[model samples]
Target: MSSRSMLLALAAVLLQTPALTQAFQDDLLQQCGTTTVFSNHRQGRLRQSGVSRVVGGIPSPEGSSPWMVSLQLLHPGMGYVGHICGGVLIHQSWVVTAAHCIKNEKYALPISHLWSVQFGPELKRFAIKEIVIHEMFAGYNHDIALVQLSNPAPYVPVCLPKSGQGFQGIRCVASGWSTTSAAPTTLTRRMGIPGPRAHVHLSVVSSSVCRNRYLSAYNITLNAGHLCAAGKGLLTSGTCLGDSGGPLQCNMADGRWYLAGITAFGSGCGRPGYPDVYTRLAYYLPWIKVQIKKHESAEKSGNYL
Candidate 1:
């Protein structure tokens, strides 16, 4: 069958299934928090070895981050607009990303269908059904958004935190497209391609430290909702400009990796003092459920259709 026809068939199967939050949480999802593809010899730890960081990011194997989804916007004339931001596959058809990726500075929401999901090795393109930004989002504070896929993605979903989970000071990892600044000033940049897609290890910083540091340097007062993490190792590089909306995953004693944060903003390409900011996933779990259920209800009643 034709590719378009097959995608339509897949979409048909998705529609027949309930997009209800409970069903999505309990039934649709599988054993999450485990990475069989980009896995480690030990059960609880993510693979932090092998790949080396030159400028900032380390090249994570393509399928290593199974839950990472690239959110792209499609244009009519230009077409094929690549990854604008990174996102995590939270539910079968729902993804979590930075709110600023969707909502404009003027608070305008973009047309949902123009955006698509590129997943797996083949970059299977899935259309977007809806875009939901946090109502309380203003400036960069609560920078989180939810996207409903037109069809279910046949990939593993990352686990969400039940509570705050006290992940502070814990080491976590984030994966996304690297920043051009993170690449060596070598032939790749000379050839116009720099900052390959990769991941970075970060030590989650305390909110007080983050607020104190940023408040002094940038005069930005961060609250509890925002998460802060800095690069590990002597080089001290981390999530850069283009890496926004990527998954900031933290592992717990349960031997499961949980979606900890959404890469929100940073001063530069892993600058020394300016640690990358992320929208704390644990802080917004309740709001995420509320938004998902509210919209899922609309979808079931054909209100969204």
Candidate 2:
């Protein structure tokens, strides 16, 4: 079997393990403190328009999306060259990403395996203090995780949606270091083939429409926690292999940008009928708050402060 297939099969078996299931259940149900309320910490606006004009996407301006980051894993012989996924800075010390980014198919990898988080256009790397993956995360459902920076990043965080905020028809942009090429399907073929940085403008598709499309074609059912978005122009364009766990950001009418989604998965890169799926931020807001609070409390207690 292919490595990807092997991993998926292993994940299925591990998910059924009683001890693992119980541990995850206990963590999922753990109570959290209520002191710190969740809110976005905006710094200021940039002179450049949030929109990018390049076909794929030009190298992002210095501070355009300061919250964007690259998560890397160090292999025994490869060092930090392996770029596992992308992430967003939700707070000075907190990052949000897909849980699968930090885990293999069978188990959550050790913290030592995580090398660093590269932030901003300069791509300064920072050590990680802690990682908190949602306990209930099973495969694609609840596909979210948080990373705490050993030292706080100086960049301003992107705002999160207010409770119940609607995203339908909103124009959101997806950014990553993935290839700009349009045809490659496998990761190896697209490896290191860099063009302009990827920043594709996409429109949010309604959940019902996205669900129906996936159901009809792939027999997959999408839940409310998933956001579906398609490319804006005639030419097919969206995220690919290296873009997992990156942000799907939307600029609101108030001129503030909010993190609306995290790129999760897709049928193929920029296929005409298949919209890329993201882990909807609003749906997971409560869980996010609880986890952050729990971690913050632990730090205060010197668990890794």
Candidate 3:
């Protein structure tokens, strides 16, 4: 069969299968087993080993951001698995990410099309139980989604902000396996060999400043749901390709890291003056709580579909 035809056939198969009843789902969960208990904070006894920080950014010490996760998909015809985006483990079974990460513009694929959520120091893979995309998401505006894992993994979830909390001007960190080089060849190689994740320090830019900058350049005003940040002048420090859906986390006064934003879009990776934009978590807190509650209610009633 032709390559295009083959892809069509595979996508058909993926779409036809029930997301919650794939044959490998049970086996994959069983094989993974219950290895570690989930928590919002890392235990002192747990070993810290695999963390690394991002583009034009410094290398973070290993295992620093335990909530970081790589969302991937398998391309059978291409003979490779691809890391399409990054996400955060928000709960034992729930993950938060950019809605665009899971939506295919060319084709409306099923949730089962997602290969797995690779996380932890060893980057173990886990099957997704369900996917919930924000109903109001349009392009990059409200670009957040949630994924429920078939089984919980051994990792710490990131702390979420309470309603009405704000994070303006706060220094935060964004980490992901995004490519550092702008060259095409480097991008391809980086995607294949996704090395240690990298992180960078960024200061939150107020909505007025961000809106003014974008309005002046792209004739687009920043929305209320968006948050912006950048590194020190012309330093070229920020997220790049493959970093979408990753968390922009801030350390609170209480000593716990709370997710401040979700990497959404930017003019270019680490480009001076074009600060990175994220979907502000504060604006979507109520929506998130509702989705979690709805999912929990469905699960309790054995209607998890």
Measured by TM-score, the strongest candidate is: 1
lDDT by residue (1-305, candidate 3, tens digit) is 54456445435533443334334544433332122222232111100112211444444566577778877665544543456678988776788988887775843433554456777546466767788888887766788999887776556677777676668777777777634435436543433334465666777776787788778987766787888877665244375432788888887676667788888877654556777888888889888889989988998999977
Q: Pairs clashing in candidate 1?
A: 86-245
Candidates ranked, most accurate by lDDT first:
1, 3, 2
The TM-score, computed over Cα atoms with residue i paired to residue i, of candidate 2 is 0.73
Off by over 4 Å in 3: 1-54, 76-80, 104-107, 178-193, 233-237, 240-242
lDDT of 2 at 8: 48
lDDT of 2 by residue, 139-240 (tens): 778889898876666556778888777688887777676343465445533221222344666778878877887789988788988988776532343643
Model 3 error, position 33 (Å): 24
> What lDDT does candidate 3 reach at residue 263?
84
Off by over 4 Å in 2: 1-55, 110-113, 178-196, 233-237, 303-305
Q: What is candidate 1's lDDT per residue for 8-110, written digit by digit as tens? A: 5545533454334554555537667767444332111112111111233555665566778777754455443345677899987799988887775533545
lDDT, candidate 2, residue 96? 92
In model 3, which residue pairs have backbone atoms overlapping below 3 Å? 50-63, 51-62, 51-63, 53-60, 53-198, 53-199, 54-198, 54-199
Question: What's each prediction's TM-score?
Answer: 0.77, 0.73, 0.75
For model 3, the run of ten residues with the poorest summed lDDT = 42-51
